[model samples]
Target chain A: MIVWLILGAAVMGFLRRVDLYDAFSEGAKEGLKSAVRIIPGLAAILTALRILQASGLMEALQRLLVPLAEALGLPGGAAPLLLIRPLSGSASLAVLEDILKRFGPDSVTGLAASAMMGSGETVLYTCAVYLSAAGIRRTRYVIPVSLAGWLAGCAVVGLFFR
Target chain B: MSAALFLMIVCGVIYAACTGRIAAVEQAVLEAGQEAARTAWRLAGGFAFFGGVIGILEKAGAVRGLVRMIRRPLRALFGRDTGQEALEAISLNLSANMLGLGNAATPMGMRAARLLSAEGGGQPSAALCLLLVINATSVQLMPTGVIALRSAAGSAMPAAILWPSLIASAASTGVGVLLCKLLERGGR
Candidate 1:
């Protein structure tokens, strides 16, 4: 499947006279430039995450969210996944994996997985990618609205899968 | 939430103040910065490559051709000019996202945004809102990220989530687009 997509893209490029080598090299250079622009924001975000982890904020967050999570029909521990989802997909996936392993895949844990599967990692990554490319400094509604969607996804999963 | 915010602020201040002495706070900040840089580099590289590819594809007419192919169905659902180049870019973004190629999707999304901006006469128009809505409620095909997680977790059926994932994404996209349309009309 990946091959087909790549081939299709290549064929399209060829037909359009887009010199593949030039495009790829130029793209790679642009990628480096984007990486530079996002470094500061990324540093701030990750630094905050580290502090949260070190201070056991995540644990406290999980504890505080247990009741709400349970009310939403999610496993009590899944609260961490909710918190993690917006910040980092990798971390959220790790938490989700742990939940699935502990509670079994067909359980409510599995249902949360299903919901998350349907969702993306919220606006953090999206904003980082797009904002960096477009050089947009202000991203007011993207984060809040995307968070709403993430919450909605979690709620739908918790409500329906239970 | 306030407490969390306070703790974060305190930590940040402390970390910032500790210039020397090899404090844990300083170390943590450094490590976090390094990690962030690594992630940023990876993501940026991915986006650049993908964005360039999308640009080349556009120059090549692949995007236009694809838009033409999908125009009918997309128009039936979106109730807009699906043949528009911006629409095609949106579709490509969504498609790449479904494949878990987020870096690839970024350029397409930006292209879409530019197209929409052009169509709206340089204003942030309803198309921007619609783009956001579509992005927020994107449909996925492979659920590659989830499959990877499931496999790492030792699931017997890593791919079992596929069907359900698709259904939920489709439902969300449908609802989100419908809401956008409703809101657009209401705002008018």
Candidate 2:
């Protein structure tokens, strides 16, 4: 799909008589600069996330949310996926797999987890990378608003898929 | 960002100490740093590739064409104060997201955010905040990854989540936009 998009872009550039190679390399250099610029922020955020995950704090938070999950008509086991969804994509994916394996894919918990994972984004990672790359210091309600969206998605998933 | 990170690390360390897992936490921080570097390296390749494509599009006036196509809706959402360049980049980011092209989405999003910031006189604009919220509550057309995983895990109906996920995604995006609108008004 992306390959097709690139090919189409090249064709479009060719028809426009643009210096496609020069344009590409110039843009690619900027891309590299921005990518490199994000490393420090990624390191900080990921290290903190890793600590949260490794020290079992993530699970502890999941445990605390289990009752809320159950109250929402989801299984207690689905709590981890919900708690971790905005934090880490890979972690939430792993939790989704764990839920599916334990509860069966067609089960209510499994379906809800799948839907929730499907709809949600890694809010922390996205905010950190984008804001840092943009060189913005103050986040200013981005996290709160994003997390509210995530919670809304999760609730919808629970209400419908479950 | 610092406050969030500080809280995470402090809470994590305290929790680890209470559970006698401080050694594991130390290991995790070291490993995470390396992992982050590795992740960044992988992202560099994708960004370069997509950036090149986007460059071609920009030079060919394709991006401008796209911006024109979505100009009204985007203007309505982001307001008239935003520049065309930011709107173009934002559209790219959003289309990639809807297509579930995460690797493509991030670079475009960063570009859009940067452009928005510049347009807002270096402060984070309402448009930028809206973009962030929308990205964080991505409206994917299909949860292809999850469906694939479900099928691999031997599910009877792996595609069952397709509509449900889309509905949930739309709901979140709607709510996010509403919240941003309300918050922008309140903040003003």
Candidate 3:
């Protein structure tokens, strides 16, 4: 991928008769601007998650999900990932690593991981990132639809894999 | 590392505020802003390039032509004509979803929604519902992000998840669309 990206940059530079360094810097600058606009949203989400974690909200949620976990054939430990899965991929991955370590690969934890691997994070985040970037605010049904799809994915994994 | 970096910044801010080190807090905010800006610019170019590719593909008639080819199968599965707008959106959405480019899928999905809305005379039609269902339960073929994570975690066969992922995604999408249609009818 690195090689392809480099080659692409090189090709663009060559075609445009621009220096590689200059072109790369230009692209980077544009990317930076896009990143800035999303900071407030990302910071707010992270802060809320941090507060939730600090207040043991996550622990309570995990405890509540334990029975469901067993019925769904997922590990109780997988609860954290299931909870975080809708919020952030990176954080969910950290939780996934914890599950994999505790339960080992090829277990139910592993299967759940496989399911998440094929799925996505919350629709709000996707909507926030893209819609905000595109400057659109009124997306009526996207959130509900995406959430339903995500829930369906989880259900399929739990029921079928069980 | 990213988490640690974030923690360090938060801690630094608190410490600085406590110590009345206004300069330190100011510097931290500036650095964070700079870092975020850099990330966004890179992301935008990528998104723009992806959106542009779809735009170019549409202009070249490739998108429409491909839509025609797949329309029958799509209609059979979706149980509706899906119109040109929905078809185009579905194609774009499917292509992006298969690539595991969730970020890239957003603009296309919105565009599809807008087109569908216009076509429906400002009402949310069944075709629009189908598009929403499909977008929500998109079938992924590559699962690139997962594969990358697996590789990073030292998986010998990062791509081994491909077939299983595809099967699972396909099944979910099928069931999801069916349920959406069923529920819509029941609601009526």
Candidate 4:
């Protein structure tokens, strides 16, 4: 990735007489601005995730969903993560950490969690925010398709595990 | 988001009170908030570094070449029916997501969303759905951050998850695009 990026920059810089330092600074500034834009939404999602988990609701939901997960052929341990992952990225990361710490990072369940986390997104969170940016409030056909893709990823993750 | 935010707070509070776990809930909320803030800080740093690199690439006009490279896949996945501006935005958006520059991807996505919504005449178009799904389930070329997490957890092969993740992401993106095409053909 670095090779390709730098090669592109080098070629383009030579041809375009680009000032690399100025461009770098400009992009860095945009990065900071984007970070600030996401903070409020991130804070709210993360805090809610904690409340759900601490209030015992998350656990109860886990127990309730475990059977469904097993019925769907996934390890029961991965059920909570599949549910939480759609809601918040940091929240899912938190769940992924707990799974790793509890099951050992090299274990099958841990591997499954890692694969799922690396593959999917904070679906509901992403859809909600992105659609809002377009000023389109109703997310018709978006959520279902997104979640379907997520489920396909989970199923494939199951397949790759020993 | 409004509904989700409302429900999360309401249900979290009521459920905690009902379960007599308000104390635990309070602590958890505080900790989660702090953790998320830390995550944001970490992401900001990552974004700053990569963003600078991208800045150089963009200013050098290399970004347009990169965008052109992915235009074929964008057309295939999004269909030829979508407009040029939206298609260009989707390609760049996917490229950012592929690099795991998600913080960068969001702002890029907003730009894409604006272009797409305008093209769709202020509604959710099938192409727009595809764009969102692709962004959400982007097949990672390098999951540097997740690999770092595995290393921190004392894994012997930190990069072991890389291939499995790619396979999973491929399956997800494949299914997402197929569904989008069908949804579009179904005339919704």
TM-score of each: 0.77, 0.95, 0.65, 0.83
Regions of candidate 3 where Cα sits further than 4 Å from its true position: A1-55, A127-152, A159-162, B1-42, B73-86, B119-126, B156-160
What C-alpha lDDT, on a 0 to 100 scale, does residue A18 get in candidate 1? 85
lDDT of 1 at B110: 65
What is each predicted model's overall lDDT from 0 to 1? 0.63, 0.85, 0.57, 0.75
Superposing every Cα of model 4 onto the true structure, what RMSD results? 3.3
Candidate 2 residues A1-162, lDDT tens each? 777898899899999999999999987887787778778888988999999988998888888998887776666767887778888888888888888999999998888889888999988888888888778877777888888887777777777765
Assess chain B of each prediction and give its TM-score.
0.70, 0.94, 0.67, 0.74
Preferred candidate (DockQ higher): 2 or 4: 2
Docking category of candidate 4: medium
TM-score of 4: 0.83
CAPRI category for model 3: incorrect
**Better model by DockQ, 3 or 4?**
4
lDDT for B34 (candidate 4):
74
Off by over 4 Å in 4: A1-11, A25-29, B1-3, B22-52, B79-85
Model 3 lDDT, full chain set: 0.57
Q: Write the per-residue lDDT of candidate 4 for residues A1-162, one digit (tens) a residue.
A: 666766766677768888878888887887666655556666777777778878888878877878766665567787887788777776678888888889878888778878878888887767765676677766667777888888888888887764
lDDT of 2 by residue, B22-127 (tens): 9999999889989988988988998788778878888999888888888999999998988877888898898889998887788888988888887555557888
Where's the lowest-lDDT run of ten residues in candidate 3 chain B?
B1-10
Better of 3 and 4 by TM-score: 4
Estimate, for each residue in B1-188, the C-alpha lDDT of model 4 and write its tens digit.
55666787788889999989999988887787677578668778766766677687777766677667877877777667767667655766777788776766776676678777765755677667777887777667777877788788888877888887888889888898888888778876
